[model samples]
Target: MAPRTYGGLAFIAEVYLGSPSIRQYLHVDTGSNLTWTQCFPSSHSFVDHIYPKYSPEDSNTYFDAECETTAKNSTPKFTYYASTGVCSYELTYGDGNLIRGRLAEEMITLQTRNGEFKVVYDVYFGCNDQAVGNQYIGTGILGLGTGKFSIVEKLGSKFSICFGLIMESKPTHNLILGDGANIQGHPTVINTTQGNYMIMLEFILVGAELKALDDPVQVHLDTGTTICHLSGFLFNFIV
Candidate 1:
């Protein structure tokens, strides 16, 4: 499905969660690994005007890790709140944005080419009650990363995104999850030891000048990072 854009910086998608479902617009962040949304009874959060807060108590399938139990002999595998016995998480962005809350599980609703459907996966998502930073254009982030707790890994480890160019008029981009991604391209494969998507850069060509690098540099393909960063030597040579 195509995601809505704001100021050509943030991409937003309409996502539904829980039983009975609460629809929310969230930022589509390929650089992140955890999906989270502001929940009701928010105490330290910046109010989001576009979508309503999610209340886990309203859903029958919602299970707070701190207050519930999993199968016998099986401990909750993800991070949790030691004080409350609930799974909890705290995210601190480079820009000083922070979100802290409990980790929970619930059914996620999606609309695919086959039509709308609901998948009851044991998703590890944050239910944030405290969020602080710049005013977010969307309610949450839809993390598309390689981490074990990421939505991609939880949903079987395959997804695709086709970014459309931004224009004067509002434009949208494609985000496909699961088996129907249908990515068409000549793939350049690289192996990595990190959780985030990383690729090796051999060299860079500017105009007609081929600037070769002394050594290959590993760069991260991050959707959440707005600006491209290069080493001092590369940046100086390029400019």
Candidate 2:
């Protein structure tokens, strides 16, 4: 993973998938739960084919995740395939962008910058074949949200992600999973809002001046989301 692209703060990770392990660059998103990547020969797509797509047929470790439930009830964010027994999903972002894919399980390999290896087997993820927005910088997204199918849950109960200076000569990484992560700092509870990470904002201070925000606002911490959004009243009050 590295720095954000252009005006956005996007850090992509080097993740290997399947038996032989095909390399893929995935943008890290703490706001999402499902780790998804673009797949080859897409039946439908609007974004230009800029990056190479992942072929599931090539991966011997890939397996389709069947729908456990009997009924196929289509929702605004998810869909089920009863005929194929495949669990498919559709996610609508804040910007109204949709990412549609099929759920599957595959072996994953995480290689650190220091040549370290951490392999996790049977990790659930989405094989995206269709999209509606610009794919941006990576082949797909690496969801790090605190969800059932997230990388954080796959690792351990507690984890810490460190973002150091973006100097290539001085590469630094201290990603700790489990009890090894130091929990000494003044910690605040993180709430899950709309399947994403959220926190209550009390007030805004600019150069020691406290800004007025009548009520506490729910602020989402999304690494994948590049833009900052503020309510009209909050925006005017702050300025």
Candidate 3:
């Protein structure tokens, strides 16, 4: 078997839905699962170009949330907008990107040690003119991490999560999960102030040196954020 590459994340794949198509990328997120993308009706949102737009008429997997028949084995809801009206299955990201759609089935491609694999899943995706311009950093988000409503809950199973960050200055950095790998050993077991949540980070290391912070920094496993963020103070100090 190929060496299992470890990344620090809750979900594994970078998957998203598009107009009449499905796109996949290496995604990083925390607590969300309404997979969608930017499309047809352009607007000033995140990077309103990477997301996909699905056409129900042409796509066999697409369905409308209003149709009662679409509710069979799926949840149908409407997304309300002050500017737009009620949208089916409205979705919002921590980064402020909003999507609207209903539950529909689609085939997804995933990478395995062997090769690419496929699975058909019922998902809520975005459609309409406003989402047309959502193309951004990653193709879309794979929402199967530890959360109240993660894809794993729907899938009803335990899954792995990992991510590799681009350490611009540092020559090496590693992200570990469950049982950590020893490449970045002696990781400080940082305490999370949050009572009980999967987002509590165990450590913040600087090339094997765990930097101690005065306050127990709140670190959450956010799936929606495309890149890791640090406050201005932390960023300056880290660099």
- Candidate 1, residues 149-220: lDDT per residue as tens digits? 578877668887777774435565777887777667877564544566788888799999998878888887
Q: Which ten contiguous residues of candidate 1 have the minimum total lDDT?
A: 68-77
Question: For candidate 2, lDDT tens digit of each residue in 109-186?
Answer: 976446798788888788888888664457787888876677677777566667666455344545555556666567
TM-score: which candidate is best? 1
Tens digit per residue, CA lDDT, model 3, 1-239: 00123233223344434334555443444344444444333443443233344344655555443343233323224443445333456555545655544334454444343445445456444443343334234434545454323445444434443334532232122222222223334434433232112344435788978876665566655554546877786776666
Off by over 4 Å in 3: 1-26, 39-54, 66-87, 132-135, 145-149, 164-197, 201-218, 226-239
Q: Is candidate 2 or candidate 3 better by TM-score?
A: 2
What's the ranking of the predictions by lDDT, best on top?
2, 1, 3
Q: What's the residue-level lDDT of 162 in candidate 2?
A: 75
Q: Estimated TM-score per prediction?
A: 0.84, 0.81, 0.51
Q: RMSD of model 3, in Å?
A: 8.4
Scanning candidate 3 in windows of ten residues, the lowest lDDT window is 1-10
Report lDDT (CA) for all predictions. Answer: 0.72, 0.72, 0.43
lDDT of 2: 0.72
